[model samples]
Target: MDSLILNILTPVAIFLFIALFTLFAVYAERKIAGFVQDRLGPMETGKYGLLQTFADILKLLQKEFISPSASDKILFALAPILIFVAVFVGYSVIPWGPNLIPSNTHTGLFFIMAVVSIDAIGILMAGWGSNNKYSLLGSIRAIAQMISYELPVGLSLIAAVMITQTLNLNEIAFNQGLLSSKEIYFLGFWKVNEIGGIFGWNIFQAPHLMVSYAIFFIASLAECNRAPFDIPEAESELIGGFHTEYGGIRFAFLFLAEYAMMFLVAMLGVVIFLGAWNSPLPNIGPAKLADWTTGPVWGVFWTLIKSLFIVAVQIWIRWTLPRFRADQLMTLCWKILIPLAFVCMAISGLWRILIMI
Candidate 1:
């Protein structure tokens, strides 16, 4: 009975967190855009425009749900919910802290990748059900882009997995912390298990993973349909892409899913490469910064801080880089990222063999 109740509340907590995060993320994006473009973003709506996203949410809630006259009503209505659910479900296996994961599946990483791919089907349904040419084109671009990028994303993550030898995300997180059961040496020489800081991170432990992380980051941007790689929703060309026909609450759900995807990918990157929930400070001499800052609560804190920093970088890149032409986007994914990802995977294997020797 207690376990059942906990399971029920876990999803509720995740939903609330996603909702609040979407609100803050939208506001932050607008302000970030304003800063980039040299203009005040939302000064009029409450103090420092803090309430702007809330106001926008209320407006969206009150707006009418409109569908195209000749559209397949069932699929059109179901698309947003399906898309949002696909992204939302990916959070279940995410290890927020040592004890905070909603579901600590052994194949947590595999589960996230599989579930998140379902959104492509939802995107296709949105485009096809609308019976609009632009919508169909946008969905095609999204499918192509996502499928193409998944290669690099998978390969890059495989590099990390090769090093960790576990698909359990919590175990991966543990391996990066001071209390790791396995011994880790810096550059296969200096034992760093006792000194857990940036040194213990996968990127530092296996320097080749820095390349893997880069490939993962670039591919993640495409996965999230973020700017530069946001060909699916190119405002100038597709006029909102696969979601062109959606409005009101349906559109809101799609929007929310996009932001949630952004956060999800960022958090995944943090867990795999940026030390997960472990503190970046190391114990040295008389100072015990890492030991003091390490706990369930601190785990959550460090995880969020690292994840948000990655999100901020995503936002900055969105505003800084111009949108990629469809051809250029595909070329980068197939030719450049895929090759680099393979190299990283090879390096990960070699690194592991050398360490064992």
Candidate 2:
């Protein structure tokens, strides 16, 4: 009975959380944009426009549904649902903290990477189904960008898996905390205990994995179709891109899915590279407070803090840089990121083998 209750409630809780988080994220993006541009944002809807996002949600719900007359009605309708569901379901394999994961599978990492990639298909459907030339162009751009960058994303992760030798995200998180057996050494000079939690994280594991993390972060930005790399939705060219034909709640789903994907990739970076839910330090000095403050509950809190920081960086980059040209986008992925990822993986693998010998 307890297990069944947990199984039933987890997805419900995550769904509600994603919905609410998307509202705040939208508000945050607007405020951040205003700050960047030297203006105040949305002051009238509520204090600092706190209610603005909620108001927007209500307005969307009440808005009349409009569909492109030329669109394939079935695929047009199904697109938003698939995109939203793909992002939402990817959360199932992520372990929030001890016993907080919805599903504890050995192949959690592979499962997440696979599930998140499904959004590409939905995106293609949205573009092709809409029957707009611009929409088709945007969808083609999306497929190309996703496929190009996904190679680096997976390869970067391979470096970490080589070190940890497991795909279970919970184990990945556990190995970063002070209680785990993984140890860090300083060029064979000094040994850092697991209590040196941040030092034990994969990003700091070796020179190669550090490069891997850098590649992973960049690829993830492209994966989520955010910022300078967001060529698929280049407003100057494609209007609203693949989602141009959608309105009302259909548009809302697509919008929410984008933000949710941002959050999801940010969390994945934290888990695979930045130490997941573990505190940045072991029980030492001021960091000793983490010993008490860094349990399962605190794990969730830390994870959110890290993930939100990444999101903030994404927003900052979005406002700071110009969008990449299509050729530049492809060149960066294939010529630069993919090769760098391969070198990083090879170096990390060699380091692991050397240490064992």
Candidate 3:
């Protein structure tokens, strides 16, 4: 009975959290855009537009659902829901903190990489079902970009897995914490026990993993279809891309899914490179206060902070950089990031072997 309730309630709670965060992210994006352009955003809503997102939600809710006469009604309606569902499934395996994961599968990382990529299918569905040339072109572009970038993304993750020798995200995070607990030096020529803290993060773990992280971060930007690489939804090009034909609640679902994907990638990056829920501050090793801060509930707190920081970087990039030309986008993936990821993965493997020896 307890397990059953936990199983049901956890997912519900996660969805609620995602919804709330998505609202805040929208507001933040607008406010940041305003800041970048030296304008006030949402000043007319509620308290500098605090209530703006909610108002927008209400307005979207009241808008009538409209589909074009030529559209495939069934597939068009299903696409948004599928997109959102794929993100939710991908979010399930994340280790927000100790014992906090909903599904602690052995193949947690693999599951995430696999399921998240399936969202491209939803985009394809939205495009084809809309029966619009623009939408179809946008969807095709999105799929191509996503599929191209998935190579580096997967390779970077596999590099991390090679070091950890496990597919479980929780185990990866746990390994980071363990790695954090001590300072090893000169191939164990000298060891300082329970001294190192923030230095233990995978981002700082080794040179090759750092290279892997760089590849992963860039690949993730493309995966989330954010700026610079947002060729599919480039307003100048595809208007609204695959969701061009969607509006009202369906558009809202697509919007929600995009932000959710942002959060998902950010959280996954934290788990893989930033030490999951581990505090950046060093504590007297193995102390109760450390556990309190790094443990399950507080783990969620740290994870949120780290994830939001990554989201902020993404937003900053969105505002700062121009969209990549389609050819440049493909060239970047195929010519640069893919080869770099392969080299990093090979080096990461070699580094792991040397460390183990």
* Tens digits of per-residue lDDT for model 3, 11-103: 999999999999999999999989988998788898989999999999998899999999999999999999999998998899888767899
Residue pairs in candidate 2 whose N, alpha carbon or C atoms collide under 3 angstroms:
none
True-vs-predicted CA distance for residue 238, candidate 2, Å: 0.8
Worst 10 residues of 3 by lDDT: 184-193
- Descending-TM-score candidate ranking: 1, 2, 3
- Looking at model 2, which ten-residue stretch has the lowest summed lDDT? 186-195
Estimated TM-score for each candidate: 0.98, 0.96, 0.94
**Model 3 stretches with alpha carbons more than 4 Å out:** 178-193, 284-292
lDDT of model 1, residue 324: 96
Deviation in Å, model 3, residue 147 alpha carbon:
0.2
Error of 1 at 108 (Å): 0.8
- What TM-score number comes out for model 3? 0.94
Candidate 1 lDDT, 1-357, residue by residue in tens: 999999999999889999999999999999999999999999989999999999999999999989989999999999999999999999999988876788888999999899999999999999999999999999999999999999999999999999999999989999986978898766567789988987888877777888899999999999999998999999999999999998889989999999999999999999998889989999997898899988999999999999999999999999999999988898898889999999989988888887745
lDDT digits (tens) for residues 1-357 of candidate 2: 999998999999998888988999999999998899899988999888999999999999988978788889999999999999999989998878765788989999999999988999999999999999999999999999999999999999998888878999988877765656655553323465535557666677666777888899899999999879988998888997899899899999999999999999999989888878877755577557547766888889988999999989988888878889999999899999999999988877788889733
Best by TM-score: 1
Give the top-scoring candidate (lDDT).
Answer: 1
Q: Model 1, 288: alpha-carbon shift in Å?
A: 0.2
